[model samples]
Target: MAKNTGASKFRKVNVDEYDEENFQDNEDADVGVVGPNENEVSNFLNQSKNVEALKAVLQNPPQGCKDKRLKDKVVQVVVRVLSAFKTSDIEKGVNALDSQSLDTLMKYIYRGFEFPSEGSSATLLSWHEKVYAKGGSGCIIRVLTDRKTL
Candidate 1:
Protein backbone atom coordinates (compact mmCIF):
# COMPACT_ATOMS: atom_id res chain seq x y z
CA MET A 1 0.00 0.00 0.00
CA ALA A 2 1.14 3.51 -0.72
CA LYS A 3 1.83 5.74 2.29
CA ASN A 4 -0.66 8.60 2.72
CA THR A 5 0.75 12.15 2.67
CA GLY A 6 -0.67 15.47 3.96
CA ALA A 7 -1.04 16.64 0.35
CA SER A 8 -3.68 14.02 -0.17
CA LYS A 9 -5.92 15.78 2.39
CA PHE A 10 -5.81 19.10 0.52
CA ARG A 11 -8.51 19.91 -1.98
CA LYS A 12 -8.07 22.14 -5.03
CA VAL A 13 -9.94 25.42 -4.96
CA ASN A 14 -12.20 26.31 -7.85
CA VAL A 15 -10.53 28.84 -10.13
CA ASP A 16 -13.94 30.34 -10.92
CA GLU A 17 -14.55 31.11 -7.26
CA TYR A 18 -12.74 34.45 -7.64
CA ASP A 19 -14.88 37.14 -9.25
CA GLU A 20 -12.72 39.59 -11.14
CA GLU A 21 -15.69 41.90 -11.75
CA ASN A 22 -16.30 42.19 -8.00
CA PHE A 23 -12.67 43.02 -7.22
CA GLN A 24 -11.93 46.73 -7.02
CA ASP A 25 -8.80 48.18 -8.60
CA ASN A 26 -6.84 50.46 -6.30
CA GLU A 27 -4.70 51.93 -9.08
CA ASP A 28 -7.23 54.63 -9.96
CA ALA A 29 -9.10 54.62 -6.71
CA ASP A 30 -9.31 57.97 -4.91
CA VAL A 31 -7.76 57.49 -1.50
CA GLY A 32 -8.35 61.14 -0.60
CA VAL A 33 -7.80 64.59 -2.00
CA VAL A 34 -5.14 66.82 -0.50
CA GLY A 35 -5.97 70.42 -1.22
CA PRO A 36 -3.10 72.88 -1.55
CA ASN A 37 -4.73 75.46 0.72
CA GLU A 38 -5.86 72.93 3.33
CA ASN A 39 -2.49 72.34 4.94
CA GLU A 40 -0.18 75.11 3.74
CA VAL A 41 2.76 73.99 5.87
CA SER A 42 2.68 70.40 4.59
CA ASN A 43 2.17 71.59 1.02
CA PHE A 44 5.07 74.02 1.29
CA LEU A 45 7.34 71.40 2.81
CA ASN A 46 6.44 68.90 0.09
CA GLN A 47 7.81 71.21 -2.59
CA SER A 48 11.25 70.64 -4.16
CA LYS A 49 12.74 74.05 -3.24
CA ASN A 50 10.85 75.98 -0.57
CA VAL A 51 13.52 77.81 1.38
CA GLU A 52 12.84 81.16 -0.30
CA ALA A 53 9.11 80.67 -0.11
CA LEU A 54 9.35 79.76 3.57
CA LYS A 55 11.48 82.80 4.26
CA ALA A 56 9.02 85.04 2.46
CA VAL A 57 6.11 83.60 4.38
CA LEU A 58 7.95 83.97 7.67
CA GLN A 59 8.95 87.53 6.89
CA ASN A 60 5.40 88.55 6.05
CA PRO A 61 3.14 86.63 8.34
CA PRO A 62 -0.63 86.95 8.27
CA GLN A 63 -1.86 90.29 9.53
CA GLY A 64 -4.34 90.13 12.38
CA CYS A 65 -4.27 89.44 16.09
CA LYS A 66 -7.00 86.79 15.63
CA ASP A 67 -4.73 84.67 13.46
CA LYS A 68 -3.16 82.90 16.38
CA ARG A 69 -3.79 79.54 14.70
CA LEU A 70 -2.06 80.76 11.57
CA LYS A 71 0.89 81.94 13.65
CA ASP A 72 1.13 78.50 15.25
CA LYS A 73 1.04 76.88 11.83
CA VAL A 74 3.83 79.16 10.71
CA VAL A 75 5.89 78.18 13.75
CA GLN A 76 5.36 74.49 13.02
CA VAL A 77 6.36 75.00 9.39
CA VAL A 78 9.48 76.95 10.39
CA VAL A 79 10.60 74.29 12.82
CA ARG A 80 10.07 71.56 10.22
CA VAL A 81 11.90 73.50 7.50
CA LEU A 82 14.79 74.40 9.79
CA SER A 83 15.06 70.81 10.90
CA ALA A 84 15.30 69.72 7.27
CA PHE A 85 18.21 72.08 6.57
CA LYS A 86 21.44 70.35 5.56
CA THR A 87 24.68 71.02 7.44
CA SER A 88 25.97 73.16 4.58
CA ASP A 89 22.75 75.18 4.54
CA ILE A 90 22.59 75.57 8.31
CA GLU A 91 24.92 78.56 8.49
CA LYS A 92 23.23 80.40 5.65
CA GLY A 93 19.76 79.55 6.89
CA VAL A 94 20.59 80.61 10.41
CA ASN A 95 22.08 83.83 9.14
CA ALA A 96 19.07 84.57 6.96
CA LEU A 97 16.63 84.19 9.83
CA ASP A 98 15.36 87.46 11.29
CA SER A 99 15.27 88.04 15.02
CA GLN A 100 11.54 87.28 15.13
CA SER A 101 12.05 84.07 13.19
CA LEU A 102 14.87 83.15 15.51
CA ASP A 103 12.64 83.81 18.45
CA THR A 104 9.97 81.58 16.93
CA LEU A 105 12.48 78.79 16.45
CA MET A 106 13.71 79.26 19.99
CA LYS A 107 10.16 79.16 21.30
CA TYR A 108 9.58 75.84 19.58
CA ILE A 109 12.82 74.46 20.99
CA TYR A 110 12.06 75.76 24.45
CA ARG A 111 8.60 74.21 24.33
CA GLY A 112 10.18 70.89 23.35
CA PHE A 113 12.63 71.11 26.26
CA GLU A 114 9.82 72.11 28.59
CA PHE A 115 7.59 69.23 27.52
CA PRO A 116 9.81 66.34 26.52
CA SER A 117 6.89 64.11 25.57
CA GLU A 118 5.07 66.64 23.37
CA GLY A 119 7.69 67.49 20.71
CA SER A 120 10.98 66.49 19.09
CA SER A 121 13.23 68.10 21.69
CA ALA A 122 16.14 65.73 21.13
CA THR A 123 15.94 66.16 17.36
CA LEU A 124 15.88 69.95 17.76
CA LEU A 125 18.93 69.80 20.05
CA SER A 126 20.78 67.63 17.55
CA TRP A 127 19.94 70.08 14.75
CA HIS A 128 21.19 72.97 16.89
CA GLU A 129 24.41 71.04 17.58
CA LYS A 130 24.80 70.39 13.87
CA VAL A 131 24.29 74.06 13.12
CA TYR A 132 26.82 74.99 15.80
CA ALA A 133 29.30 72.54 14.34
CA LYS A 134 28.75 74.08 10.91
CA GLY A 135 29.76 77.52 12.22
CA GLY A 136 26.23 78.85 12.74
CA SER A 137 27.13 81.65 15.18
CA GLY A 138 23.61 83.10 15.41
CA CYS A 139 22.02 79.73 16.08
CA ILE A 140 24.69 78.79 18.60
CA ILE A 141 24.32 82.08 20.48
CA ARG A 142 20.52 81.93 20.43
CA VAL A 143 20.55 78.35 21.65
CA LEU A 144 22.98 79.12 24.45
CA THR A 145 21.06 82.14 25.75
CA ASP A 146 18.83 81.70 28.81
CA ARG A 147 16.31 84.35 27.77
CA LYS A 148 12.70 83.53 28.72
CA THR A 149 11.26 85.99 26.22
CA LEU A 150 11.76 83.66 23.31
Candidate 2:
Protein backbone atom coordinates (compact mmCIF):
# COMPACT_ATOMS: atom_id res chain seq x y z
CA MET A 1 0.00 0.00 0.00
CA ALA A 2 1.31 3.47 -0.88
CA LYS A 3 1.27 6.09 1.88
CA ASN A 4 -0.67 9.22 1.03
CA THR A 5 1.48 12.38 1.66
CA GLY A 6 -0.26 15.82 2.12
CA ALA A 7 3.11 17.54 1.45
CA SER A 8 2.91 16.83 -2.33
CA LYS A 9 -0.68 18.10 -2.56
CA PHE A 10 -0.13 21.40 -0.71
CA ARG A 11 2.42 24.07 -1.59
CA LYS A 12 2.83 27.13 0.58
CA VAL A 13 0.70 30.05 -0.44
CA ASN A 14 1.76 33.41 1.08
CA VAL A 15 -1.62 35.09 0.84
CA ASP A 16 -0.12 38.45 1.86
CA GLU A 17 2.28 38.37 -1.10
CA TYR A 18 -0.55 38.48 -3.65
CA ASP A 19 -2.86 41.43 -3.93
CA GLU A 20 -6.47 40.31 -4.34
CA GLU A 21 -7.53 43.75 -5.62
CA ASN A 22 -4.70 44.62 -7.94
CA PHE A 23 -6.88 46.29 -10.55
CA GLN A 24 -7.04 50.10 -10.58
CA ASP A 25 -10.06 51.93 -11.89
CA ASN A 26 -9.79 55.20 -13.80
CA GLU A 27 -9.54 58.06 -11.32
CA ASP A 28 -12.14 60.79 -11.41
CA ALA A 29 -10.57 62.53 -8.42
CA ASP A 30 -9.45 65.49 -10.49
CA VAL A 31 -12.81 65.90 -12.19
CA GLY A 32 -13.85 68.92 -10.15
CA VAL A 33 -10.56 70.72 -10.71
CA VAL A 34 -9.69 69.67 -14.26
CA GLY A 35 -11.60 69.98 -17.54
CA PRO A 36 -13.64 72.89 -18.92
CA ASN A 37 -15.41 74.96 -16.35
CA GLU A 38 -19.12 75.52 -16.93
CA ASN A 39 -18.77 79.17 -16.01
CA GLU A 40 -15.97 79.74 -18.53
CA VAL A 41 -18.16 78.71 -21.48
CA SER A 42 -21.17 80.51 -20.08
CA ASN A 43 -19.10 83.64 -19.48
CA PHE A 44 -17.60 83.48 -22.93
CA LEU A 45 -21.03 83.17 -24.46
CA ASN A 46 -22.07 86.25 -22.55
CA GLN A 47 -18.95 88.19 -23.44
CA SER A 48 -19.02 87.35 -27.13
CA LYS A 49 -22.69 88.35 -27.28
CA ASN A 50 -23.17 85.90 -30.15
CA VAL A 51 -24.31 82.34 -30.40
CA GLU A 52 -21.64 81.73 -33.01
CA ALA A 53 -19.05 82.11 -30.28
CA LEU A 54 -20.40 78.92 -28.76
CA LYS A 55 -19.03 77.05 -31.73
CA ALA A 56 -15.71 78.77 -31.28
CA VAL A 57 -15.46 77.88 -27.61
CA LEU A 58 -16.50 74.33 -28.33
CA GLN A 59 -13.85 74.06 -31.00
CA ASN A 60 -11.27 74.58 -28.28
CA PRO A 61 -12.62 72.28 -25.60
CA PRO A 62 -10.31 71.59 -22.66
CA GLN A 63 -7.56 69.39 -23.95
CA GLY A 64 -7.49 65.81 -22.60
CA CYS A 65 -10.74 65.92 -20.72
CA LYS A 66 -12.08 62.52 -19.69
CA ASP A 67 -14.63 63.81 -17.21
CA LYS A 68 -18.16 63.01 -18.32
CA ARG A 69 -19.99 65.03 -15.68
CA LEU A 70 -18.01 68.15 -16.50
CA LYS A 71 -18.54 67.59 -20.21
CA ASP A 72 -22.26 67.00 -19.67
CA LYS A 73 -22.61 70.44 -18.14
CA VAL A 74 -20.96 71.94 -21.19
CA VAL A 75 -23.23 69.91 -23.46
CA GLN A 76 -26.27 71.20 -21.63
CA VAL A 77 -25.06 74.71 -22.23
CA VAL A 78 -24.40 73.84 -25.88
CA VAL A 79 -27.86 72.37 -26.36
CA ARG A 80 -29.38 75.47 -24.82
CA VAL A 81 -27.37 77.73 -27.10
CA LEU A 82 -28.26 75.51 -30.04
CA SER A 83 -31.92 75.65 -29.12
CA ALA A 84 -31.74 79.43 -29.08
CA PHE A 85 -30.61 79.54 -32.71
CA LYS A 86 -33.06 79.94 -35.60
CA THR A 87 -33.53 77.11 -38.08
CA SER A 88 -31.58 79.03 -40.68
CA ASP A 89 -28.79 79.53 -38.18
CA ILE A 90 -28.50 75.79 -37.55
CA GLU A 91 -27.27 75.12 -41.04
CA LYS A 92 -24.87 78.04 -40.86
CA GLY A 93 -23.58 76.87 -37.50
CA VAL A 94 -22.95 73.36 -38.78
CA ASN A 95 -21.25 74.71 -41.85
CA ALA A 96 -19.01 76.97 -39.78
CA LEU A 97 -17.58 74.12 -37.71
CA ASP A 98 -14.18 72.77 -38.77
CA SER A 99 -13.51 69.03 -38.75
CA GLN A 100 -12.37 69.03 -35.11
CA SER A 101 -15.37 71.06 -34.00
CA LEU A 102 -17.61 68.81 -36.05
CA ASP A 103 -16.36 65.78 -34.18
CA THR A 104 -16.89 67.52 -30.83
CA LEU A 105 -20.34 68.58 -31.95
CA MET A 106 -21.10 65.02 -32.94
CA LYS A 107 -20.06 63.85 -29.49
CA TYR A 108 -22.41 66.39 -27.88
CA ILE A 109 -25.19 65.38 -30.24
CA TYR A 110 -24.86 61.75 -29.14
CA ARG A 111 -24.65 62.72 -25.48
CA GLY A 112 -27.76 64.86 -25.81
CA PHE A 113 -29.59 61.77 -27.01
CA GLU A 114 -29.14 60.18 -23.61
CA PHE A 115 -31.51 62.67 -21.97
CA PRO A 116 -34.19 63.54 -24.52
CA SER A 117 -36.31 66.55 -23.72
CA GLU A 118 -39.17 68.27 -25.51
CA GLY A 119 -38.03 69.07 -29.06
CA SER A 120 -34.35 68.49 -28.19
CA SER A 121 -34.17 65.33 -30.25
CA ALA A 122 -35.34 67.12 -33.36
CA THR A 123 -32.67 69.75 -32.91
CA LEU A 124 -29.98 67.13 -32.27
CA LEU A 125 -31.14 65.16 -35.31
CA SER A 126 -30.95 68.26 -37.46
CA TRP A 127 -27.42 68.91 -36.26
CA HIS A 128 -26.52 65.25 -36.73
CA GLU A 129 -27.79 65.30 -40.30
CA LYS A 130 -25.73 68.37 -41.12
CA VAL A 131 -22.62 66.99 -39.43
CA TYR A 132 -22.94 63.56 -41.03
CA ALA A 133 -23.32 65.16 -44.42
CA LYS A 134 -20.22 67.25 -43.88
CA GLY A 135 -17.94 64.89 -41.95
CA GLY A 136 -19.27 61.55 -43.20
CA SER A 137 -18.74 58.30 -41.27
CA GLY A 138 -15.15 59.00 -40.30
CA CYS A 139 -16.11 61.72 -37.85
CA ILE A 140 -18.37 59.33 -35.99
CA ILE A 141 -15.67 56.63 -35.90
CA ARG A 142 -13.22 59.04 -34.28
CA VAL A 143 -15.74 60.03 -31.63
CA LEU A 144 -16.66 56.39 -30.95
CA THR A 145 -13.10 55.09 -30.78
CA ASP A 146 -11.71 57.97 -28.67
CA ARG A 147 -10.72 57.02 -25.13
CA LYS A 148 -10.89 60.58 -23.86
CA THR A 149 -14.61 61.28 -23.55
CA LEU A 150 -15.89 64.82 -23.94
Candidate 3:
Protein backbone atom coordinates (compact mmCIF):
# COMPACT_ATOMS: atom_id res chain seq x y z
CA MET A 1 0.00 0.00 0.00
CA ALA A 2 1.17 3.54 -0.84
CA LYS A 3 1.58 6.29 1.82
CA ASN A 4 -1.71 8.26 2.27
CA THR A 5 -1.79 12.09 2.41
CA GLY A 6 -5.11 13.81 3.26
CA ALA A 7 -5.19 17.03 1.23
CA SER A 8 -9.00 17.25 0.92
CA LYS A 9 -11.95 16.58 3.18
CA PHE A 10 -15.12 14.80 1.97
CA ARG A 11 -17.76 12.59 3.52
CA LYS A 12 -20.34 10.17 2.21
CA VAL A 13 -23.87 11.41 2.88
CA ASN A 14 -26.73 9.12 4.01
CA VAL A 15 -29.60 8.96 1.56
CA ASP A 16 -32.01 8.60 4.47
CA GLU A 17 -31.21 12.19 5.51
CA TYR A 18 -33.59 13.37 2.73
CA ASP A 19 -37.20 12.95 3.83
CA GLU A 20 -40.55 13.88 2.21
CA GLU A 21 -41.14 16.65 4.77
CA ASN A 22 -37.83 18.31 3.85
CA PHE A 23 -39.28 19.53 0.54
CA GLN A 24 -41.86 22.28 0.47
CA ASP A 25 -44.91 21.89 -1.80
CA ASN A 26 -45.68 24.83 -4.09
CA GLU A 27 -48.96 23.66 -5.70
CA ASP A 28 -50.99 26.34 -3.91
CA ALA A 29 -49.03 29.32 -5.22
CA ASP A 30 -51.03 32.35 -6.23
CA VAL A 31 -51.66 32.72 -9.95
CA GLY A 32 -52.63 35.87 -11.80
CA VAL A 33 -54.83 35.39 -14.84
CA VAL A 34 -54.97 38.79 -16.43
CA GLY A 35 -57.38 38.97 -19.35
CA PRO A 36 -58.20 41.84 -21.68
CA ASN A 37 -60.69 44.49 -20.65
CA GLU A 38 -63.94 43.77 -22.45
CA ASN A 39 -65.30 47.28 -22.20
CA GLU A 40 -62.18 48.76 -23.76
CA VAL A 41 -62.16 46.26 -26.62
CA SER A 42 -65.84 46.82 -27.32
CA ASN A 43 -65.28 50.55 -27.33
CA PHE A 44 -62.51 50.24 -29.88
CA LEU A 45 -64.65 48.00 -32.04
CA ASN A 46 -67.66 50.26 -31.77
CA GLN A 47 -65.51 53.21 -32.80
CA SER A 48 -64.17 51.28 -35.82
CA LYS A 49 -60.63 51.67 -34.51
CA ASN A 50 -59.51 48.27 -35.72
CA VAL A 51 -55.86 49.15 -36.14
CA GLU A 52 -55.62 50.68 -32.68
CA ALA A 53 -57.48 47.70 -31.24
CA LEU A 54 -55.16 45.31 -32.96
CA LYS A 55 -52.13 47.07 -31.55
CA ALA A 56 -53.68 47.14 -28.09
CA VAL A 57 -54.53 43.44 -28.20
CA LEU A 58 -51.06 42.43 -29.35
CA GLN A 59 -49.25 44.78 -26.95
CA ASN A 60 -51.21 43.56 -23.94
CA PRO A 61 -52.75 40.11 -24.30
CA PRO A 62 -54.43 38.13 -21.56
CA GLN A 63 -51.35 36.91 -19.72
CA GLY A 64 -51.76 33.59 -17.91
CA CYS A 65 -55.16 33.28 -19.50
CA LYS A 66 -56.57 29.78 -18.78
CA ASP A 67 -59.99 29.83 -20.39
CA LYS A 68 -59.91 28.52 -23.95
CA ARG A 69 -63.25 30.20 -24.69
CA LEU A 70 -61.85 33.55 -23.58
CA LYS A 71 -58.80 33.11 -25.78
CA ASP A 72 -61.02 32.13 -28.70
CA LYS A 73 -63.07 35.27 -28.18
CA VAL A 74 -59.96 37.42 -28.26
CA VAL A 75 -58.68 35.58 -31.32
CA GLN A 76 -62.00 36.13 -33.05
CA VAL A 77 -61.75 39.81 -32.32
CA VAL A 78 -58.26 39.99 -33.74
CA VAL A 79 -59.21 37.99 -36.85
CA ARG A 80 -62.21 40.22 -37.43
CA VAL A 81 -60.06 43.31 -37.13
CA LEU A 82 -57.48 41.84 -39.51
CA SER A 83 -60.20 40.94 -42.00
CA ALA A 84 -61.57 44.46 -41.83
CA PHE A 85 -58.40 46.00 -43.19
CA LYS A 86 -58.69 46.81 -46.88
CA THR A 87 -56.04 45.18 -49.05
CA SER A 88 -54.71 48.57 -50.07
CA ASP A 89 -54.29 49.58 -46.41
CA ILE A 90 -52.59 46.41 -45.18
CA GLU A 91 -49.08 47.53 -46.08
CA LYS A 92 -49.59 51.02 -44.70
CA GLY A 93 -51.02 49.80 -41.40
CA VAL A 94 -48.33 47.15 -40.99
CA ASN A 95 -45.57 49.63 -41.72
CA ALA A 96 -46.87 52.00 -39.05
CA LEU A 97 -46.42 49.44 -36.23
CA ASP A 98 -43.28 49.52 -34.03
CA SER A 99 -40.93 46.53 -33.80
CA GLN A 100 -42.51 45.17 -30.63
CA SER A 101 -45.98 45.47 -32.09
CA LEU A 102 -44.73 43.75 -35.22
CA ASP A 103 -43.42 40.79 -33.20
CA THR A 104 -46.67 40.52 -31.28
CA LEU A 105 -48.60 40.60 -34.51
CA MET A 106 -46.50 37.71 -35.74
CA LYS A 107 -47.33 35.78 -32.56
CA TYR A 108 -51.06 36.35 -33.07
CA ILE A 109 -50.78 35.38 -36.70
CA TYR A 110 -49.39 31.97 -35.76
CA ARG A 111 -52.00 31.53 -33.06
CA GLY A 112 -54.69 32.49 -35.53
CA PHE A 113 -53.47 29.75 -37.81
CA GLU A 114 -54.27 27.16 -35.13
CA PHE A 115 -57.98 28.05 -35.34
CA PRO A 116 -58.67 28.67 -38.98
CA SER A 117 -62.02 30.03 -40.11
CA GLU A 118 -63.53 30.57 -43.53
CA GLY A 119 -61.41 33.04 -45.55
CA SER A 120 -59.14 33.67 -42.60
CA SER A 121 -56.29 31.62 -44.01
CA ALA A 122 -55.69 34.00 -46.89
CA THR A 123 -55.85 37.04 -44.64
CA LEU A 124 -53.49 35.48 -42.11
CA LEU A 125 -51.13 34.50 -44.91
CA SER A 126 -51.09 38.09 -46.09
CA TRP A 127 -50.31 39.27 -42.58
CA HIS A 128 -47.61 36.62 -42.14
CA GLU A 129 -45.95 37.68 -45.39
CA LYS A 130 -45.94 41.34 -44.44
CA VAL A 131 -44.73 40.73 -40.87
CA TYR A 132 -42.03 38.34 -42.07
CA ALA A 133 -40.80 40.96 -44.51
CA LYS A 134 -40.58 43.61 -41.83
CA GLY A 135 -39.46 41.48 -38.88
CA GLY A 136 -37.61 38.70 -40.70
CA SER A 137 -36.99 35.29 -39.07
CA GLY A 138 -36.06 36.87 -35.73
CA CYS A 139 -39.66 37.70 -35.03
CA ILE A 140 -40.66 34.05 -35.52
CA ILE A 141 -37.83 32.98 -33.22
CA ARG A 142 -38.99 35.40 -30.54
CA VAL A 143 -42.57 34.18 -30.83
CA LEU A 144 -41.45 30.55 -30.48
CA THR A 145 -39.18 31.26 -27.51
CA ASP A 146 -41.71 33.43 -25.69
CA ARG A 147 -43.49 31.77 -22.77
CA LYS A 148 -46.57 33.97 -22.83
CA THR A 149 -49.37 32.85 -25.13
CA LEU A 150 -52.11 34.99 -26.66
- For candidate 1, the 10 contiguous residues with the lowest summed lDDT are 29-38
Cα-lDDT of candidate 1: 0.51
Local distance difference test scores for all models: 0.51, 0.72, 0.76
- The list of candidate 2 runs beyond 4 A from truth reads 1-51, 60-68
Candidate scoring better on lDDT of 2 and 3: 3
What would the per-residue lDDT of candidate 2 be over residues 29-129, giving only the tens digit for each residue? 44334434456656656774445555645755543566567666777777876676667677777787789888888887888888789999998898888
Q: Residue 110's C-alpha lDDT in candidate 2?
A: 86
Off by over 4 Å in 3: 1-33
Pairs clashing in candidate 3? Answer: none
Give each prediction's root-mean-square deviation over alpha carbons: 18.0, 6.4, 5.6
Compared with the true structure, model 3 gives a TM-score of: 0.71
lDDT of 3 at 19: 79
Ten-residue region with minimum lDDT total, candidate 3: 25-34
